[model samples]
Target: MDPSTLLITFLFFLAALLYASVGHGGASAYLAVMALLGVTPAEMRPTALILNILVAGVGTFKYIRAGRFSWSVFWPFALTSVPMAYLGGRIHLPVRYFELLLGVALLFAALRLLIKPGGEREGLHPFALGWALGIGAVLGFVSGLIGIGGGIFLSPILIFLGWAETRQVSGIAAAFIVVNSASGLFGLLQSHPPLPAAIPFWMVAVLAGGWIGAELGSRYLTAPWIRRALGVVLVVAALRVLVV
Candidate 1:
């Protein structure tokens, strides 16, 4: 393979490793990389969603198997999110608008990574189902619109509200990413655009990285430094998108 393709493959693996460790699907990071590579917005969205599915799928299985997941914490949000994500995927934006919005999204993800929140509170707060549903709907729509799985936003919300523990948040976020990404991809497929030919190689790289990261995360691995490093990369990519 060419050097550029090899570099992209390696970056994809690294993104998956860091994100899956935190129960994310790495869609934002993938988008940032593509943005740096000068990929069109139309290609970026579906490609990111496809990668999100593979990586987050691994995280979901690992976190659930490790008993970090809570059904009560997961289902209410997912119920509203699925349909909203599908709806959002069906609506296409102008290329300029999409790039602008995606740049903002990359910045947000970078911010989330840089500002590491404290661990779960001693006493978990009771979740408000109504609030969760509303937030989920909004996030889901944004996910489909921006090609993210929404875990980047959801994790912090849960932490700020003290609704779930850190591990629980990770597990729930992973599962949430999976469903939303899958729903978004399904919606995108209706337009019948061909995916990038290199998707299979990217998928294998992400899966390998995702598995190792999930294994470490589910057991006992804290990666604040890794997150911060990735955050810096996202900031650069976001700047690239906004400037060019």
Candidate 2:
């Protein structure tokens, strides 16, 4: 219909490619896109969460099949995150607050990930259920409140705590994002809020991008490329949230 809609869809495609490559679902980036177009704030969270599910679902399957997944590593964080994310999604914020928080979150993630890559070999750190649960709950709630999948927050913590190597972190983040998005979407649906009608169009774009990007990142692309692409996505997300 509208030319702008096509542009936004294209942008979503590219964002999904970059974000899914690094194990993200690109909700923050989607929110940024919606913001720039002056899409209704009330609609943004539900819409973004829906898109997050599709892309993260693809990413999760791809990474897990590539042998990057660890159920033991995933369950602890997911245990608390799912419910907490649901709780957060149920509470609605004012439009301005949502925009501000999304921008700040994107900026923080961009800066955190811009640091040099860590150890090449996977770290053999012991799984700490307590730490994972605590971190998961916090990020999940925040993700729900702000309309994200929380992978950006979780992956960095995993790397910092030496729980997983870079690629492993990507896989974990992909799975984590999928569940959180599902939970958040469930919560949002309860409110009878409207989701964008363009969802079907957007979903196809993201799924295709997610498949291609996740495949390349998991099998062909090196760690450095994934990291760089993630950085670019985060920076663009930050700018979109702030300026739009």
Candidate 3:
């Protein structure tokens, strides 16, 4: 492989490690980096989504084994998201529009982190199901369009709604990402044009980096810090997408 390809792969793996360490799937960073490297948006989205599935799945399993999984809090959102994700995958939007929207969403998410109100709750609220489903569907659709795993939005919503603590939220977000990415990939498969082959070296690098990072994140990192860091990264990524 060429030096440029090698460099890109290395950057990708590094980004994966950073994101996984924070309990993110790294789609926003991946998209920004790919854009900088001149990858076509068409290819970048699906590729990032595939990577998200791999990383998030590993993290989700870790969270689950640690007894942090919350099915009741997760299922309603997942139910709404799966179909929307498929729909988003089937439709192709203008690249500039998609990027702009993603940028705006990230910015909003960043602002949310900055101004997050304090909250504490014992369990899921009965009325939050509708909100969860609606937000999940919107996030899922965007995830499919952008090839993310939807955890970026999911985690924030959980925090805002007081459904779970930060660590538990991370685990739930990982599981949610895995499920939505699987559904989105299934949808993408039905497209007229199929996805490109997984670059074996890149895949291996991402998987290795993600596993190591996620393990450390689950064991050592605090949820609030993870969320804050993820928000900051998203903001930077959004700016890169919009301006560069």
lDDT of each: 0.81, 0.84, 0.76
TM-score against native, each model: 0.86, 0.91, 0.88
**Candidate 2 C-alpha lDDT tens digits along 54-118:** 99899889998998777888889999999999999998766566667767876777776676556
Per-residue lDDT, model 3, residue 78, is: 92
Output the worst ten-in-a-row residue range by lDDT, candidate 3.
Answer: 118-127
**lDDT (Cα, 0-100) at 27 in candidate 1:** 88
Candidate 2 lDDT score at position 18: 86
Candidate of highest lDDT: 2
Predicted structure with the largest TM-score when compared to the true one: 2
lDDT of 2: 0.84
Candidate 2: residue 21 Cα off by (Å):
0.7
Off by over 4 Å in 2: 95-109, 117-121
Q: Please provide, for model 3 over 1-244, each residue's C-alpha lDDT reduced to its tens digit, 9 standing for 90 to 100.
A: 7775677788878877777766677777777777787677667767777888888887888777776678888898899998998888777777677778767877897888766666445255444777888988998897776677888777766766778777777788888888888888777767644343445676787888788878877887766677777678668767966886
lDDT digits (tens) for residues 1-244 of candidate 1: 6677688889999989888888888887788787777667668889899999999999999999999888998898899999999988887875566667767977887787678586436226788999999999998998787678988778767766878777777888999999999998889889986677687898899999999988877888644543564466557556755765
Runs in model 1 lying further than 4 Å from the true structure: 95-123, 222-244
Runs of candidate 3 with Cα error greater than 4 angstroms are: 114-127, 192-198
Error of 3 at 44 (Å): 1.9
